[model samples]
Target: MPYIEECIQSILAQSFQNWRLLILDNRSTDSTDSLCSKYLADRRIEYITNATDIGMIPNFNQCLDLCDTKYYAILSHDDMYADARAVEDSLTLLENDPELCAVYSHLNWIDGNSQTIARKKFKTMGKVASDTIAKTSIRTCRNLFGVPLLVRAAAVKGHKYESAFYFTADIDFSIAIGQGLYHYVIDRPCYAIRFHASNTSMRDFSKTRSELNSIADKHRIKLSVVDSIRMRINDWQTRAGKHLFYLYLDHFRKFMPACQQR
Candidate 1:
């Protein structure tokens, strides 16, 4: 509920107050649904409570399916915009360029103290962008990290997130949309990503890699068979390093409890 509260506050504080909020509570074990209901009573907000926990892609698809707006965006319960100007700036870019199917901004990692920890993976961006933006994010926003995009609702309604991707749907969706869809990248300091050890990215690196590779291959974006093996190998090696790091803390016990034992 605290996380949802923070997210809603970010939405409410948007400098561009014209946008509406549609939240789908995917069978949260927490009280996120109740908090969303309270926000929905505001007439500007529309909220839906899911009957079961439908993983990320489907949940995102469901959210977009309900949108009647010209643009659509996904804001996870755990992340928020840095300030009111973020949306105002993004909307301005999108409005000016009808060709832009999406717009993303530079995001900074923020600690629990609300201090800048570091810039997120995708470092190159612009106020006016092109569809080619997706190719560059291949390295940084590749797998489980690329929700920083504000995409067109039509685009979202067109490509359904692969149900097979439990964690990397954003990556697959971004790739599938390809350079066919235009995107604008706002260079300003816009998104604030809260970094907590409890975040899903920290726990699901395994499934994350598989989903990423699956998407990349599906897009025919990867190189030859040997090169594809190398990419997957690199992804696995990184995850292995993280796994070994946790093992030293005697905390791997808890971390691997739910993760399937390899």
Candidate 2:
């Protein structure tokens, strides 16, 4: 319940007051209902308690079904916006570009104490021209990391979230939208994922890679044999680059004066 409240407070403090927050309590046994009740005074927030616990994927679909606004994003119970201007800035970018179907920002991973653990930035993320956006998306997948994105309601009006891939549905949905309309990238880290023992991804890490492969197969978004080999080579290069960077940093730290050391 504390985590839930933190998530809600982040939304309430957004610079963009025009948005609505739909809090769906999927039959939680905790104090979630009571915690949500305290925020009813803010008309922008709406809390709905489900009679029974629907699975996670269906709950995600329900969010899509209930959305009436021009844009909507799914904020997980353990995730929150990084700042007051995240939504405002994201929506502004989407509104400014009619061709963009959605906008996602870099995400910071935080622990249960709300201290940042790591920050991940996708190499291909940023303002991309329409001509090369699809290629970039196919390559990077926007490094989704289950972070929220402000997406055009109309761009995905008829499409439904694929329930088959539990851990990789966000990637599937993003690719679906990207295949049609271009999506812009906000370079700043605007959203945060609370990484803790209870996180589903942490619990089921084994399924992620396989599920992603299944998603690509289901969507027929496969890479050619040559492209696949090139991707593998790139993966190795990226790993080696990171290894060399860390080695250099470690050597530099060891050689630094004692006064400069942490």
Question: Lowest summed-lDDT stretch of 10 residues in model 1?
Answer: 136-145
Q: What is the C-alpha lDDT profile of model 2 across 1-262, one tens digit per residue?
A: 5698888888888888887888998989888988889899888888887789888888988999999999999988888998789889888888888888787778787766787767878555666543354333334333343354688888885777777777557777776666656777678788887766566453343344455556567667666776556545554554465456445444543354574765
**lDDT, model 1, position 31:** 77
Per-residue alpha-carbon lDDT of candidate 1 for residues 1-262, written as tens digits (9 for 90 to 100): 3677888898899878888787787877887766677676688887777888877678878876787887767887778887688777777777887666677766777644455656754555553333344433343334322455467666554778777876666766766654465666666657777765566455566666556556656775554666555656676677776577445323543454378765
Q: Candidate 2's error at 235, in angstroms?
A: 9.5
TM-score against truth, every candidate = 0.78, 0.81
Clashes of each: 1, 0
